[model samples]
Target: MSYLDHCSTLLFFVQHCGARGRSIGVLWFSLPSWAELELGRAPVFWKTMNGLPPTSGESLTLFYNPAASNLAPNEEFGIAFNGGFNQPIMCGGEPRVMRIKERGEADLPIYTIKIQAPKYAVSLIFSFTNGVEWDGPYKLQFQVLKKWRNKPIIFSNEGLAEELSKEGACEGAIFPDSCDHRELRN
Candidate 1:
């Protein structure tokens, strides 16, 4: 096994054994460097939260599903968005996901997601219903968003907004890695 070297994203598995089950805990996000990342929306959040929880409250854990993942064969690894969190074991709550559609220069197949955290929220609130259609093999490079149907309320609960406050979405998962569970398996 690889010892904890740097701080990179750690895709974990959700397993329940002896009733308690094991949570793949905080995704160890080891960034390359400060300048290399866009870590601008973290600070103001208050609470522990992860969009996709390990245990679904019913003692059921969410494992990584490879088949449902989207991978870029050209790229070495898959990158998914992560909802803001203060530190390991603590979640920053749900973020604001912007649903953008460009027109002329707007229709250039591009979009943006933003975020902000509220006070006293225990989990991240999100809407998986927002989606973007792609074209060709390159499309696979982008991960599929669940487009959470109920986003407004989710954000409100966590003090996150889809309006002027900010716009963004956290990374999710990729293909091949068993840690991804966007789509379930039989």
Candidate 2:
């Protein structure tokens, strides 16, 4: 969970979450050093986080199950994706699918998706594009954008980081601080 100790360049990343691991295929670019995190606890509340301050260039979205976490438990969460980051976000169907590039061009050059979740439970996933990872000891946070009731945004760090109190959401994690971060040789 490199949610802390960052690492990544970022060009908009997206994830489809559910009871299991990630349902929809996860597309990611190895940032220089970074990983993403939500405002609160697990089964993050996406809509609540999206409404926060908008990241400079990247678009942050949180997709989740309205009934997955601790709420309904019957209805399913929905989210979808479109490559080239040129497609519209559609939240429907279980295990929402996103178009994928051919074998050779496996790297996701661009894309976007929307995760739809219910009010009580938190189910937010985000996609970030164009970001330079940061080294922390710095203060950042996820906030519910004042404009809307459930939108969240990562402040500062250009979506790479949000402005908030360091409550230790992801300290001592494996991501940006993974042993892989130990300067390897090719």
Candidate 3:
């Protein structure tokens, strides 16, 4: 099967297995360096964490979604995350989804999804349709706030925000320190 097809199937399994409280041993693969750069800049993988997790106030909004106008034909999207012990598994609870829409006349379509994970660190994987046939499977990593309420919480992608961002939502967040099979690559 093609690499993208394989990734789609694996993501499907991950989602299904997660829903059933099952864990799978996933193998890791590497993509070409060019593909890695492209995946990093894709708007579909653009993420932002609006505020700190609540200690007892209004919930913080986490934005994870694709940009509508930038989608290529036959595009498919999937997301997976390692929710810290205190958080719910991916797809476990209701998350507010924002559909694709145009932002004014700029033609930059904005799509956003909001999820709340209180008191837990999260490691996120975003998968998108391959831009090149032989680019192999491509995925990018980002994480939510790892330290909450002055306490250090551990998750898969701990202390990754520094490498992925210099400013914006992911600043000071956590992410995987290295690329491996668990990453979204074929």
Clashing pairs in 3: 28-181, 160-175
Relative to the true structure, candidate 2 reaches a TM of 0.20
Better of 2 and 3 by lDDT: 3
* Global lDDT scores for all candidate models: 0.22, 0.24, 0.29
Taking every candidate in turn, the Cα RMSD to the unseen true structure, in Å, is: 17.7, 18.5, 15.5
Q: Which of 1 and 2 is ahead in lDDT? A: 2
Instruction: Report the C-alpha lDDT of model 3 over 35-122, residue by residue, as the tens digit.
Output: 3323333233322234322222113322222232233322442322223212232222222223343346743443433322222333
| TM-score of each model, in listed order | 0.21, 0.20, 0.29
- What local lDDT score does residue 151 receive in model 1, on the 0 to 100 scale? 41
**lDDT digits (tens) for residues 28-125 of candidate 2:** 43211111212112222222234432232223333322122222222122222211111112111122232221223432111223321211111123
Which has the greatest TM-score? 3
Tell me how candidate 1 scores on lDDT.
Answer: 0.22
Off by over 4 Å in 1: 1-26, 31-97, 101-110, 122-186
Candidate 3 has its poorest 10 consecutive residues by lDDT at 129-138
- TM-score for candidate 1: 0.21
Q: What's model 2's overall lDDT? A: 0.24
Candidate 1: tens digits of C-alpha lDDT, residues 1-186: 123211111322111111122332333222122222122221111111353222111111112111122211112221222233222122223322322323354222122333222232223222111223111110000011224223444553344222213322222211122233234221
Q: What is the lDDT of residue 22 in candidate 1?
A: 32
Give me the runs in candidate 2 sitting further than 4 Å from their true place. Answer: 1-93, 103-143, 147-186
Error of 3 at 90 (Å): 3.4
